[model samples]
Target chain A: MTELDRVIHEPARLRIVALLAGVEEADFLWLLRESALTKGNLSSHVARLEEAGYVAVEKSFRGKIPLTLLRLTDAGRSAFGGYKRAMKAVLGKG
Target chain B: MATDAQLRDLEQRPQRYWNADGIPELVMGLVWIIWGVALLVGEALPPGRGQQGYWMVMPAILVLSGFGANWLIKRLKERLTYPRAGFVTYREPGRSARLLSAGVAILTAATLAFLIVTGRQGGTEQSAAPAIGLILSLAFLVAALRQRAPHYLALAGVALMLGLAFGALRLGWDAINWMLVLLGAAAALLGAWRLARFRRCNPPSVEHHP
Candidate 1:
């Protein structure tokens, strides 16, 4: 039996990673809108994903306002792909 | 754990984002308007043998519209969509999509060349309208189906109708120009409506926390 990626196993994080996988990069508000996670909760999960080297976070300013952009790293993409395969296999649908 | 439906929705987020702003449609509308103007001008002042160089402006309009619209759309996105949705850079589609796009481009070129050659030989104004209409319909249909965008389907229907009116009914040249102008107006309105709705749905986030 193949084990799931623990980092992406959590429901909220799984959703976040899945959303990020579809785009090259997304900003914090886009993630918030899509994931429906609270500001603090979303931030923490993004930080954890960043720490695991699965995501890259960049801080920049659009005008005077700060913008936080998040992207799935190569590792993140690979992990997400693996996670999907594992899920499908476990569901007996692979 | 996310449900299967939830994951599928997540996978489609980028496609939604790409269409959300409606900038592409607006740009396309402007391009059509320009082409209509070019066609009308060519009709009003028929290019003579020595002055056939005037017809070259048609291709120039196309090339410039492509580059200019891209730049304008980027700037518009920066102002309109970036603040509210927080910007997202989308990835290109897979290899199969690219190959399909190339195939379509080749087919369109061949079809357009055939129409132009046939029209010149026949000395008919009607030939160009159907060709343009067919191309527009195919482009809209492809985009609509691929993106699951119902609005584009409406555009495709309109394009087909206009094509039939021009080709089958043998409508005059001015009628084709007028129809294209009307389509451009409709596209602009659609884009504006979608842009307003997108803004209302996704208000800009207030927090600037890093």
Candidate 2:
């Protein structure tokens, strides 16, 4: 497996990247709801992905509420595509 | 943890959402051409008073309205601030609904044409176009309601057309002219309101890339 695949193989990080990849950007609350992850768990995983350059985070205030928007980076997209292909190949479905 | 070097690399990548100003321009240009053609044809072709000439103006007015709408949409796009979302997926309307709407639009245009051609002589002959338009409109309203689609604009269009047709037949040509003017004003007002709402909802973004 490629090094990128290794990074994305973690269950929490994988789910975080997958959700962000499908949208242009998503609110932190939306990601939590969709992934069914606890606030702390989701935040930790998001931080890891953000550190890995798989996601970009924008923190701002929507009215009085603090909003965190997450977007997948180009590297994240390429890595995700590669991981999927590698998985398919391993499963003999590619 | 990812390194600072990685974050810089990620930031260099391009964005996905591109401005779509050209699409509105193309649509507006096409509407203008159609309106120009209709106006020229209406003027060149001589028909009886309140006949073909009058009916031809309908297409011209519709095309101009379309042009104005496109222009307004283009202006609104410039001010949209929200982070772009992917296309929203909605349930498709049933086959019956689609067919009914298409049928009504076609029938309404056809009936209007027929009345303009046959009733040009200013005779006392009863025109069926108005009745047909009303029935077609009702059918469309039912279909739109069944599918839970936005039918206000369709409802308004149908109502205006039917009102004009009825006024023309019952009251006379002068009443029909007044009704058309009222419809035009209403449509313009609605279009302006929608444009304003669109602009307010969407704000400009400096970070977006093509």
Candidate 3:
């Protein structure tokens, strides 16, 4: 049996990755709104994902306000893809 | 763990993000309105250099309206949506999306070319507006079905109905011109309605970087 990717198996990280996968890049605010996570919790999960090389983070300012952009890395996309396949195989239903 | 259906839903969510602001509809409305007015004005003008310049306005409207709408939408989102929902730069659609778009474009061109040739060969004067409009309406219908957006589907239905009416009635230039103007007005009104509702639902919140 192909084991699930531990990095993507966590529900919160999975949700975050899933959202990022759908778009080119999403800013911190967008993620925050979509994920409905508190600042601290979302940051920790994002930091962990970044550390694992699954997501890239860029910080900049939109005018005076700071904006943080997030995108799924190639590694991240591959990991997510692999995780999905593993899940599907485990479930044995398409 | 989310169910398979739930996962599928998540995957498809980004599409709903595209017209969240209703700005695209407003832009399209403006374009059609201008095109209709140009056609009407062209009808009255004498056949000369002046008429030629008048017809040229259609292309100018298309290009300018397209670019201007994009710029306006971006600015509006920056002010309205960004503060409330937060900012998101959506990922470009993948290869399949691009291929599908290209296919649609080619099909549309082919259909138009066929219409023009057949009409001319048959020695029948066929108005380009109704034919083109029907094709576009069908295209919108297909898109709405794919996206599963009810509002878009409704618009598609209206367009389809109008296109059929135009063809069946063998409408003249004047009738077509008025129809275009009405269509544009309807689109703009619908957009405004959606925009107001969207604003009510999504109130801007203080930036929280989480």
iRMSD of all candidate structures: 1.6, 13.0, 1.7
Cα lDDT tens digits, model 1, A1-94, are 9798999989989989999999999889889888889889999999999999999999988778888889999999999999988988878788
Residue pairs with clashing backbones, model 1: none
Positional deviation of residue B176's Cα in model 1 after best superposition, in angstroms:
5.1
CAPRI quality band, candidate 2: incorrect
DockQ, per-model, please?
0.70, 0.07, 0.66
Better of 1 and 2 by DockQ: 1
| Model 2 C-alpha lDDT per residue in residues B1-210, reported as the tens digit of each score | 333333333322112112222233233434544554555455455678756656757766875687686666545443341332222112245799999978977987797677656766665334443544465456546644543334334544655485646646674433333333443344344444544554565443323211
> What residue runs in model 3 are displaced by over 4 Å at the alpha carbon?
B93-100, B120-137, B164-169, B173-176
lDDT of each: 0.82, 0.54, 0.76
Query: What's the lDDT for candidate 1?
Result: 0.82
Off by over 4 Å in 1: B1-5, B49-51, B92-100, B119-135, B172-179, B208-210
**Residue A74 lDDT in candidate 2:** 93
Tens digits of per-residue lDDT for model 3 on B1-210?
766676666666666666776766776787778878877887889999988887777667766876787788778777777777777776666799999988977987687568657766874433655665666577678777777666776676667667667666775546567668877877788778887888899886756564
* Prediction RMSDs, each to the true structure: 2.7, 12.7, 2.9
RMSD of 2: 12.7
Per-residue lDDT of B179 in model 1 = 68
lDDT of 1 at B203: 80
Clashing pairs in model 3, backbone N/Cα/C closer than 3 A:
A23-B91, A24-B90, A24-B91
Worst 10 residues of 1 chain A by lDDT: A60-69
Model 3 scores a TM of: 0.85
Write model 2 residue lDDT over A1-94, tens digit each, in one string: 3233767778667777766655667666556645667878888888888888889888876555456777889998888777766766665576
